[model samples]
Target: MSFIRPEVRAMFLRWREALVGAAILLLGLYWSFGVTPGLLSWVGYLALIIGAILLFAGVQRGRARMGGGGPGVVQIVERRIGYFGPLNGGLVDLEAVTSISLDPTEHPRHWIITHEGGPALHVPINAEGADVLFDAFSSLPGLSPGRVASTLKHEGTAPIVLWRRPDLEKRIARLH
Candidate 1:
């Protein structure tokens, strides 16, 4: 038995980033006034910057969930991600993934996981258990967690490539 409903759980995941930012901002205020005052009051600015970044992340996350959810539930276990969507879905190995892209212009937004010699798998951002992906993708080298959340609100019609295998990037560079 679980204390939190799945829907509520998902909702929390969706807004968690923003909530974190708010907390940081509050801490900054306390640091400025309570912990360090006068000359060190400027320290609060650090919190403000961090809070803004976190708040932005939260906004983008909320944007991704604008449509409630599409036709899928994602599962991540032992470095493998499985997506079950209505029309199409499949599993992909985290290590074998070539790149992860965010297609924000889509109806509900999607995370396109790509692999060499295989068609990409599309996972809706608002799908149940989609929150697991944040941790999974965070493990990748040279990938920024803030950037991952920020790209959820990318302002473009085309898909935004969030991260690519170093080898893939080199290969693309060679092709050019």
Candidate 2:
């Protein structure tokens, strides 16, 4: 007996974080510009800053999430990512990850997580629990949420390298 339609509900759930951030941003804006001076105004300024950061992060997270229902399950535990797909599966340690790439040529697109001394683990963009990869990928050094989101939205046929370990880049440069 739900009043909301399924599609609307799904959309809301997908952008829940951004929606909450927007609410906070609006509240902060009202407080900062509305009457009531003194300490309350200072608090409003603080809220403004926090709200802005949350809003930015939320938007990135929202963009990174490609709806689920793909063929697999992703799990992150103790700084390791495990993907169990119908045909193939593998584990990738966060610390050992040397590069992250996106293969949009595939039917559902795939995130190619390459690690040191191991075959790259290909996880579909819409795999179950894949949304959590946003947080995992963000934890990598020098990887920005905005860049991840942009890479996810890339329309290229060839795989795009989203991130590469700085140390690895230097080593490769030395070899070349």
Highest-lDDT candidate: 2
Candidate 2 residues lying further than 4 Å off, grouped into runs, are none
TM per candidate comes to 0.66, 0.93
The runs of at least 3 residues in candidate 1 whose Cα sits more than 4 Å from the true structure, single-residue gaps closed, are 1-13, 16-68
Against the reference, the lDDT scores of all candidates come to 0.81, 0.91
Reference-based TM-score, model 2: 0.93
What are the per-residue Cα lDDT tens digits for candidate 2 across 1-176? 99999989988888888888888888888888894788877878888888888888888888988888999999999999999999999998899999999999998999999998878999999999999999999999999988999888789869999899999999999998
RMSD of 1: 5.5
Q: Name the 10 consecutive residues with the lowest summed lDDT in model 1.
A: 61-70
What would the per-residue lDDT of candidate 1 be over residues 1-176, giving only the tens digit for each residue?
Answer: 99999989877766888889989888777877777466556778788789888887776555445334557888998999999988899999899999999887887788999986679999888787787787788789999767876777577889999999998899999999
